[model samples]
Every structure is written in C-alpha cells, then in structure tokens.
Target: MIDSFETDEDIVVVTEFVDKQLYALINSEGPMPEELVRQITCDLVSALFYLHSNRVLHRDLKPQNILIDALGKAKLCDFGFARHMGRGTMLLTSIKGTPLYMAPELIKESPYDHNADLWSLGCIVYELLVGVPPFKTSNFASQDCISFLQGLLQKDPRERLTWPDLIYHPFLKGDVLVQQDLAASLPPLTEPLSDSQQLFKETQRQILLDRQPRGSKLTKFVDYFKQKISLEEGNVKTVDGEPMQISPSTTPTPDNPANSNSQRVHTSKSREKKKSKSFEPKSQTEESESDEENQVQNYEWLDYLHRSMEEVFNHDLSCVFKPPLVKVATSPLLKRNFSPQVYNSVACLLILPFITEDRNSTRLKTLLESYAESNVVDLLVQGMWTLLAKKKSELDEFDLVKSKQLSSERLLAIENIILLLSYLVYKQPYPKVDIFLNQFCNAVKSRGSSFALVTRHLLTLSKRRPKIVSDILSIYNHIIRILPSQSLVVLEAVIGNSATKAKEKKQIDLGKFLDSPNAMLRLNTCVLIRYLTRKFGASPYKYWDDSIKQKLVRNAKEDTDLKANVAAGLAVEVIKKLELITSA
Candidate 1:
C-alpha cells in the first residue's frame, strides 16, 4: 500500500506493482487445471467479501481488472467505478461496467446494487474455463460448471447467488478456504497472445451475435412469386404454354370505389368459360393444349403493391387508441384541441412508408396513399371516444380563443366513423372483412362502451343538426347486425336508466326518422327497427306508439327508394309477428 494525491487535471494514485494481468494467463493457456480455477475463485470471493463488508461496490470486476504480481497473488484493481454505499441505501439505478459482463438488470437500465459485481465475477470465471464469456454462446459441455454459472448469471437479481450463498455452493463446498498461496500451487502463466482490451472487444462482438435472432434464408423474388401464382391458379396453362391466370382483381363497386372493373370482368368471364367446358369431352388437339396464360411479368409491380399493403396491415395500429390524457372540448359538436397522443399516433403512421425498403417505388407510394385514406377512417372510428373526454383543465382557460378556431375535428371524426360503420354493415371491406370485424369487435368489447359512447353522442347531436340522421342510424344498424347480443347491452347504455317513460321515449324515437324526407335515413332507421324487433321481439314495441307502427306500414308500400321500401316492409312484418306473439 502507498499514499497518493490528485493533480490539477487528473486523479493519480500510487500502489504496489504487479508482474502481469490475469488476462495474460487465460489468454495464453486457454483453460487452466480444475485445482487452479478453484483457488482463483476462492481468492476473488474472499476479496469481494471484504469489500462488501465495508459497504464498497467494485462495479467493474473483469479479468482485465484483476492483476497478478511476482508472488502469483491475484489483486483486484480499478477503483474508477467503485462506490461506497450509504448504510441505508437500497439499490443503484446508474449503469456501470463492460457490455460483455454487465448484469441483465443493469443492461435493462433497472435498479441494481452489489450483486452486479458478482455477475461480472461469474463472467470472468466462465471466460477462464472456456476462453470466452458464457454470453458468447459456446457449448462448454460440463453440466456442473453450467449449473454453478446459472446460479450467478440469473437475469433476476433477487434470484441471483449472493456472497453468503455462493460460499456453500457445491462447486465451492470445501474449497472456500484458500489452502495454499498461489505462488506455490497455481499453474504458470505463459506469454500473452493479445491485450485485455482486444479480447474484451471480441467477447462483446460474440455476445451480440449470440443475442440476435438469425435471419430467414432469402428466396429469389421472381421465383417465389412465380411459384405462388402457379399454386394459386391450379397451374392452368394456355395453348401456347403461357400462365393463363393471375390473382382475380376486383371491380369498382359502390362500396369499394378503388376497385378495377375491367379486371373483375375478365376474371368472371374466365371462370364462366372454365365452368362451361369442364363436363365436355375434349378432342385430340384440344387435349394437347393447356387452358391458361402467363402474365407474371406484367403484374410484378402489382405483387410489390400487395407486399406493401400486407406490411401496413400487419403493423400494430392499435397505438392510436391509446391517446394521451388531455382536455378536449366537452360538447360533441365543437372542435377539440389536438393532444400529444394525436401527434404520437401521427408519427407512428408516418413511419409506415419507411418500414419497407425501396421507399422510392411508385407502387409503394400509391399503396401508402390508399392505406392512409382507409386508415384515417378507421382511426376516427376506433379513437373517437378518447377525443370526447370532458376535462376542465388548463385548456379551458383559453376557451373563447380556442372555440373561435371552429375546428371541425370532432364532427369530422364522427362523420367518418359512422360512414365506416355503414360500409362495414353493407359492403364488408374485401380480402379479410370477417377477420377485420372480429378484431374490431373484440377491441370494442374490451373497451366497454367506448364506441357506444361515440355513437350515442352522435345520435344526440343529430337531434339539432338533422343532416347526420342517416349516419347515426346506419351506425346503429351496423352494431345490431354484427353484434346481435352486445347490441342490446350497448343500446341499454345508450338509452340509460330513465326514471320515467317520457325520458326513455325521448332518448330514441324511431318513428321520427320513418317520416323523414331523407330516404337513406329512413332506410337505415327501418333496418335498425327490424333488427331490434327480431332480437327483442315485442320489447321495443312498448317504447313505440301506434303512430310508429303505422308509419312503418305506410313506408312499406309507398317509400320512394326501393331499398328503403324493402327495409320498411321487413320491419312491418317483424313488428306484426312480435305483436301477435305478445297478444297470444
């Protein structure tokens, strides 16, 4: 031991000199004999025990930090990262130590303490046995050694071996007491092949390699798509040996306006031709010719577009539902201020285009534009409730100024949501409509009336606006159709627990829409009524007066829109049947 002082610019200390580092021995000799490792373990544990007894933490404990002198004794150095814990302190959250040897808790940026040093010591021990740290993924085949290492390398600090427990482990049962001095009993050190820093870097590299998931084997894009198309089309070939079929493209319907009409027509004609000839016997020339045509080269760009859409669909868009808690305008008709969560969700969406490579591809750009349109509608539907939270926070202080901006965010949000609900009820978005509905319904169920709140709010606002009646009724029609039983629950919530029949009757009056001039609104109202009667039988009839039933009968025969007439006709039948049953 020696006294030392710090200079103006640096801290310096004097200490007894050492002949070589322990890294020199491990680097050159590979694995030492069993007796020598046991002795080293005993010495290091004793040093750690003394350090812990004084409340000192040697945060960095690696082979490079331990020096061996002329007497062959191991010395723990590197006080740079050491800290003295106060008597009552529990854990340290600051990260310290080398990457290859840091404890899992430290790597995760979690709270940890003295046990971290023990993990580093375990790494050093593993390195001594296999010439590399255990995290580097080598198969060191000794079960006993592995078990001992597992005790120290536990990811959970609470379960890791502490000094008190390590002393009695099977590997160190009777070897806790250092029997002889290292000078007389340990193996001799050889010339070092590499410095400690270089070895540590190599260890770091190996650990990274071990922790990462292996990438899947690459497939040729052309070949893969070719095989996919072949399997999908039943390998139908044309007379000239061409691929005769591709994925059936959709036509622009009233529901999906972006669809391709010509492509759909071509696919329909192809299917009809195949069906008409399947039963007829073929001549010799006809038997020799194949029935399909190859168009893979022409549709390669389409395949790329499909891949991009799949990527967007698979992304976790649910983050939009987790809006930050910020005050929004209470009234459903007014514009609401933007919240931090909205910006975060917008950022998440903007990053989608860059998720796949070839950001410059025109097909990807078009696909993202299309996705953004539909996704905006979905985002409004799924997250509208979050924007409706009535909070009297700081934003309320500037109410007059904010109100004048006339932000139509909430109204637009409501409009798009109802439109989407109507589309889902009628058109059913192509490719995976059922899957989308299943997931959407599950999310709604878990949220517990979040969507219902938005729907009910729109219904209330429609009382004054009048233009949104069709939209609100369409939403109810969708809910009752898709979620028959859940719709009853949501409807009960919407109507609320009215103490008087007048209040309940005023909550939702189906007869008002039946007499409206708007045909779509009347149609949607009829559909809503029909579904309610079918599900609840005569229970909804109690809420309606004789005029409501009379209006239903009038619309059944005289409505201008045929679809509205059909819907009214159906509702009249349901009401009559349910009323008859009630009378019975």
Candidate 2:
C-alpha cells in the first residue's frame, strides 16, 4: 500500500497521479451532462463495494478523497481512519462523516451497517442533479436526516438498494443511464472540453497560461484552446431557453483590424448597458428630502463640536486666572469681575482655529500674535492669583458664607487653565514666554496661599523646558522672601515640591530660616531640608547645618502641637533621605 501524509491528524493512501478531480471539473465548468455524473458515480460505487467486501469500511468518504485518473477512472483512497469488520459483524462507533452527507443513523450515534455509505451516495447524486445539497438547514441539530433517508434511500436497510439497485434508482434511470453507457464505452476521458463551456473555462485557461514557465508545453495548449474557442460559433442557450445570438457584425476575428475595431465597439456597448442597469437615481423630490435630513445632521454635529471646543478652552483658562472673592462680592456694582463664562469665551478665542475649518493657519497665527501684543499671559496670571486669594479668604470665613459659594470650583478652573497653557507652550513655542514668566513670577510673589498652584505650574514647565530652571528658581526665591510667617507652611510645601529635581535641591537654602522666631518656620525649614537631602543625594546636615538639626530635635521634644509634629516628621524624612543618598 502506498502511503502519503495528508494533514497533522491523519495520512492518505497514495494512488496513481491524476490530472484533476471529477468534482472540481464539474463544479468549475458548470453541471456536466447527467450521464457523465452517473458514470462517475457508478465507478465510485464499485470502488466502495470492493472496499466493503474486503472488510474495510470507508468511514470518511467525500468528493475530495475520491481521485480521478487521467483515464477518467475513479479510485477510492485516504483510508487513514477506516475500520475493519470481521464477517457478519458491523462496525458501529462514534459518528464520523462529512456533515452534509452523513447518514441519519450515523448522526444519531445508532448502530449502523454499510447502509450509511449508500446514504452518502444518495447525497452526492442529489448535489450533482441540483448543484446544491438537499435538506439545507441553518440548525444542524434540528435537521431530521431520518426523513431524508426514508424518502431518498428507504429507512429499512433491507429495503434500501444494493449497489446494483442504486444504479437503477428512478432519479438516475432515464437519459443519464444512456449517457453513462456511452461514456463507459468511449476512449479515456480527454482533457476537459474548452470551447463548449462557460466564461469560467476561458478565465481558467488564461490563469494557467500565465502561471506556466517560459517555453512550456502548457502555453501551446492554452493558445490552441483559445484559438479554437475564439473561432467557434455560438450555441449556448440563455436562461429563457432561447438561443443566445452572436452578432456577425460585431464578431472578433484573429489579426484583422476591422474585426478588432468592431469588437471594441461591441464591448463598449455591452459595458454601457451594464452601467445603465447598475445606475440608480432618486426622484427630485426624494433627493431634496435627503438633502434636508443631511443638513440637519451636519448642523447638530457642528453645534456639538463647538460646545466641546468651548469646554476644553474654558477648563484651561481657569488654571491661569481664577477670580478673587472680593471681586466676586463687588461684581454687582463693578460689573467687570471675571466669571466662568468670560474665561470660557477667552479660551474659545485662543483655540478657535482647532474647531473652525474655514480658519486658515496664517489667520490663526495672526490671532495669536494679536493676543500676545495685549499681554494676555499677564492678564491670565493675575486672574489665577486673584482667584487663589479669594478662595483662602473664603475658607477662613467658611461659617459666614454658604458652602455653595465656596471658591474650590473657581480654584479648580484656574488650575485647569494653567495646565492647558503649559501644554500649549510645550507643544508650540509661544513667542511671549518672557511675558508669561514675568507675570507668573509676580503672581507667585503676591499670593502666599497660591504657592501650591504656582509650584505645580512650575513643575510642568520644568518638565517641558529644563533650561528654564534658573528662572523658576528666581521666582521661588522671591516668593519665599515676601510670604508671611503663617504662610511659611505654603513656602515649605513649594520648596518640598521643587526637591523633585536633583539640581533644584541646591537652589533652595532652608538653613536661612532656621533662626526664625516662628516655630512653624523652623519646623517647615527642617522638613524641606530633609526632603531635599533624600531626593537629591544632598547631606541633611549640610542643608540644615548641625545647629539647625539640634534646634529641630529640641523642638520635637518640647512643642506638642504643630511645631512638634512638623519637627518629628522632618526627623523621619531626614533619616530616609540619608539612607537614599548613601545608597546612591
């Protein structure tokens, strides 16, 4: 027995090399003469009979496994999973066959004999006759194969036909039987007919022609078939059973200019007809209605886009300029106090280009230049500082004012604006960086409670532009000097924030505040110094000086409230920083 590996799961019995399979030949060239299908089916049945007589059950019989030699003789192969049955014993096990052609008994996992093979044969014959399988259903489990078996093959095994009886089944008993006899008596099945087929044959010929290597015999065969078909007269029938007419005036002839010209004209007309058939046009009234619907949808989308753009801009501006409480309280009289609406409008103006398609890049650049000239950065910075101061005053008098009027919302808005602007600056180099920095420095110096907000903005800026560290350090130094003793905690927070950078650690000198009379000042100074040491590999002793450390230790032991708490926290931070620095 010849053997060949078929797939990862099984092997196939090797047979004589065949040019093609009978199923593929029929499928590609359309339904063959019924006689040809019968002849092929007879050969398949004979092979199945022989295999069964030898005690081998072809459990997985399918069209692909049935090989057709060049002589048109069918052979059964691929018996990798075939089971052997001793005399008088039937093989009945798990269901295994192609789903569409499987026997009802097999699908139900019932004990079955060779009758299952006959059921599959009926399915194949039905497919050849109808160009599709019988009993097509979406629900595989619901398909009652028993009904098909009973009607097509007779339910009882004894009643079902043997191989001899199947060949004479009513469906295959007419003109097909005569044609089968003729095919069987003829010489070997020649290479499939080329001229008397559909356009698919011509396409296949062309593909095969192209795939052949240079100077191959297949090229000669392709040319021979192409010439024969090109010269043949039309005989095929249309679906309506009328003869398809080929106009002699438009017929293509080999190597004739007149024929070529006429052929092109005929092709062009055929294409025009096809185009007209596919083309569709709505009535004027219908078109007008569609246009109106589209216009409404477009307007809705535009409106939503505008609102989203406005929201993004407003959020960003709030970070730059949060309104002050004093200004909020006196707004009724002055009517000039900044509000969320005003900030939103200003932000929209800044980012309007992103939302508007009609606005050109040059026009946007001009708009940005105009805003830069008006010192918009300074206005935004001042607004943020004013808003922070108002929030602090309101917090101090929380009982006097209703909770709804709290400035946290305004503070958050201003923070958003600062972040937005910071992002814009990083993405694109704004020509007015100096103006923005000067205004930001002034704001940081004036509002002590706004240090956290200012520090965060500076942190973002530092990440974007490391070269601006000196400028940021200058602003930090100025803020530390002017901030009140009570606000030293804010200063300490800002200093601790700056300690994120290894280089910025040296810029802050916390030891200078060690001698301050305010216990909070000394406590914050120790905290900040310890943080810098840990973050930047700086020595805690160097940052606080030995005397300052002693003072902080003494304060932790004496003062019980804020001062002691701050000192104790600083002590822990100092040891952690020391360990990190030493490890580094």
Candidate 3:
C-alpha cells in the first residue's frame, strides 16, 4: 500500500469494511475459539514489540484498529501520530492518543515510552478474550483520554509494565513463543524524521485556494498542526476564488413563430403551465374556508350579543327605556346572505343561554316571557336562518382560508362560550342549567362545523358537570367518525387536556376509543394515557381490565406509527406503576 504513494504525505491505504466490530463478532458468534484469540493476541504483541524495538510508539491501540485482512491476518494502518524512541531515551512529551486505550501515566500528561503502547495492547487482548475492556468503567468514569493515560503511564514509570513482564503474565502467557516470533520479524525502524513542512505548505495552499480567509497567523498555525497529525483532505479552491466545475451542455434552440405549428405548441405549453398553477388541492381550501366561516360567524354573533347586553343594561340603569336596538347592518353568513334584522335575531338566539345563568335567572325568565309574548323568539330563529344564508355567500370570497389569526379568534370565542356556560351551570338550578346546556349543545352540533372547537367547549363543560362527561364523550365519538385525520388532532388535544384536569369529577373513559383502528387515534390515545399516568397518576389500565392491557400491548407491538415507541415507553411506566402499587 505504501509503494503507490508519490510522496510520503500522499500515501493511500485500504481496508475491508466488516459488518461488525471484533468485540460484537466475538460476543454474538461466541468467542473465536480461545486459542485463535491467543494466536491473534500473540501476532499483535509481536507487531507492537517490533515497532517499539525500532523506536516507533503506536500510542493508540484497540480492537477496532486490529483489522483482519484478506487472509485473516491483523494489519494496523492508522499511524498519523506514531513517534520514535532512540538510544537510551524511553520518554516523549507529546499528549496524544485515544482515551480508553491510553496508559494511566500518559493520561496524567507525564512523559512516557514504548511501554505506554504495551498497556493499550493489554486492553485490546483482554477485550478479544472477554468481549469487553478490562479497565473500562460502566459510566465511563476513567475514560477521559488524559486522565486515563496519566493513571496507566504513571509518573513513577516503575508502575508501568514492560514488554517481557506483559508477555509472561497469566492473562497473556497462553501462546508466548509464536507472539515473540511475530514481534521479532518486523523491519528495523531507521528512516530520518521527515519534517512535516511540505505537508503543512500544501495544506496552507489548499486553504487559500478554497477562499477561506486566513483570519490570523494563529489559525494557519492550528491548520498546520492538524495537517501534520491527520491525512484529511484540506478544503481547496482556485487562486482567484472562482467556483470550479465542468461546464454545462449547450442551450436549446429558441421558438420560431414563423412556423405556425411551433407557435401553437408554445401556446399550448404555456396554457398547460397556467392550468397546473391554477389547480390547488381541494382539502386545503375547504379546511381553510370552514375555519374562516366559523371565525366570521362566531365573532359577528358574539360581538352583537355582547353589545346587545351592554345596551340593555345601560337603558335599565339610566331609566331611559330607549327602544331596544332591534336591528343592525350585517354581513353575509357562512352559507347564505341575511338582512340586518335577521342578524340581530341570530345574535339574540345565542344570547338567550346567557340570560339563564344563575345570577340572572329571574331577569332571564322575565325577558324570555316578554320575548315570547312579543314574538321576538320566533323572529330570532328566523334571523338565524338568514345569518346562515349570509355565511354561505361570504364563504366564496375566502379563497386563502384557514388563516392562523382566524383560528386563534375561533379558539378565543370558544373559550368565552365555555366561561359563559360555566357561569350558567354554577349559578342556576339543574333543570334550568340543563335546558340551557341542551340549547348550547344543539347550537354546537347543528353548526356541524369546526367540531374540534365544539368538542373543546364540551370537554370544559364536562369537567364542571361530571354527568356531561358522558355527553362530551358521545359527541367526540361522533366527531372521530366524520372528521378528517388533521381535524382529529384538535379533538384529541381537547380530550387529552380534559382527561388531565384535576378538577374533573369523572374519569374520562378512553378505553372504547383507544383501540380504534385509526393509527392516529390510537397514537393520540396512547399519548393521553401516558400523559395522564405520568402527570396525574391516572392509570387508564386500572379503569380498563386485563383484556384491555393485553390488547394495548398487542396493538403497541404491531403499530407502525412512531407512536409505537411512545406506547412502549408508556407500557414500561405502567408496568412499573403496577409493580409499585401491588408491592404496597
């Protein structure tokens, strides 16, 4: 391999890529028959012994470096930092080498000799026979390169093992003669130390060519050191810093309008491109429109209702008895166009639920009685249909639908509705609150739009009224049947959030839905179960029987989504929790 090089720095090396490291091969294939390991160790010790005898110290040695060549012989290649020891000199003061394989003295930054390399050889031999390193720490406590070398290569020097002592040790004495013979056959080391000056110069030239501006001489010095220690290719560029590459093929001929067929072909191509650009995915548009329609309708109605209440209270407080602002200008509804009076009626219909709150029951009842007597309730129902018509017209204009700001507005509106419902439930009696709750649920279910937001509101109500948890779960069950996968993510978030609330009076029974064939739903359910168990100590498995646990384990094992990992983790946690509870 060394013979192909034009220069020492240009030497090329090659090795086979094996499927597994030596340690892994030994463990899984069951130890290369102890005798083979002994022979291999002997060959390796011979190589190290010869290299040291010739004043070459290989500071790094590990099983990974002991490559089995085409003939199944060990060949060591990496020697970017190998050093020489001559005459009586047995120490060198360079801090280098791999951490795990370095001797303790070297780790301590003490000057060391060929014996340091012998210690690393010991580590490799032990690993070969036992499938693990001898001095290796479980948590890698003593593996820091410098610290480990210091201990192995101890400053006292006497503590370090010599080649003769190591070869005869019980751990390495099994086949000594063959090892010594191999060690004795390596060529004598005698080449004068070639200054790495040429390598450094070539590296500097490459760096400058690559357009890498030399920030300081210190950076160049660091680059010089790196080049000397490794054979990695330097980033090179042209002297003028121009990007270098092979040129592209010739351009195509321009269209000739004089040729009528050519003109027609060009026009057709342009039209086709235009048509492709015009086509947008239908689902993306529909989802956006649905979100926007929800926002515009909810905001228009809620804002109107809130203003109507303020006007009513202002008139009552001032004793003005001003005629109620019965009508106002209105925009188109989600699916249809409606007049101002119809819009007011729609707003009034939604506000009726607010009137039945605990603090305002009497006033709300009186107001309802007056509206019934005056036919206001009927007019409001009519207005709702008109608002629906207006919404239909506006829907066409929302081309780039599902704006983030609109979704946020919808969330806020839903949160407000929940707050209003909570006030009603807290202050009103059961019959009245139940009546209003039915009205709220009807409005949500009727819209049949943005069911995720609706589910979230239902979830909040369920927390306050434990009986309502069943109702919300039923609605969620219906939602998962009709909603797309993306929409389901929203519902899952709401369900998971509610399941974790400490204030929830009833446990959310996710058992029925957890096994849904939909992978996303199953994943989401597992996520919720994991979160609940971790955060609230709610073991869904307890609520679910052993059959459910077995089913869950099977599903988790077979599920293809990344959620299987999460499920597996959760399974471990659940098992741990069960063990703890059972022991107690």
Per-candidate RMSD, Å? 28.0, 34.4, 32.8
Residues 407-489, model 2: lDDT tens digits:
33343334334532432322222653544444444544565543544443333322222212222332332233222232343
What would the TM-scores of all predictions be? 0.34, 0.26, 0.27
For 483-508, candidate 3 gives per-residue lDDT tens digits of: 32333343333443344344332333
Cα deviation at 67, candidate 2, in Å, is 2.2
Comparing 1 with 2 on lDDT, the higher-scoring candidate is: 1
lDDT per residue (tens digit) for residues 331-374 in model 1: 11122333322322232232333333343465444433343334
Cα shift from native, residue 239, model 3 (Å): 28
lDDT of each: 0.51, 0.42, 0.40
Best by TM-score: 1
Model 2 spans > 4 angstroms off: 1-14, 135-152, 155-158, 167-584
User: Considering lDDT, which of the candidate structures 2 and 3 is the better prediction for this target?
Assistant: 2
User: What's the residue-level lDDT of 307 in candidate 1?
Assistant: 37
Please give the lDDT score at residue 89 for candidate 1.
Answer: 35
Cα shift from native, residue 71, model 2 (Å) = 2.5
Q: After superposition, how far is residue 320 of candidate 2 from its true place, in Å?
A: 78
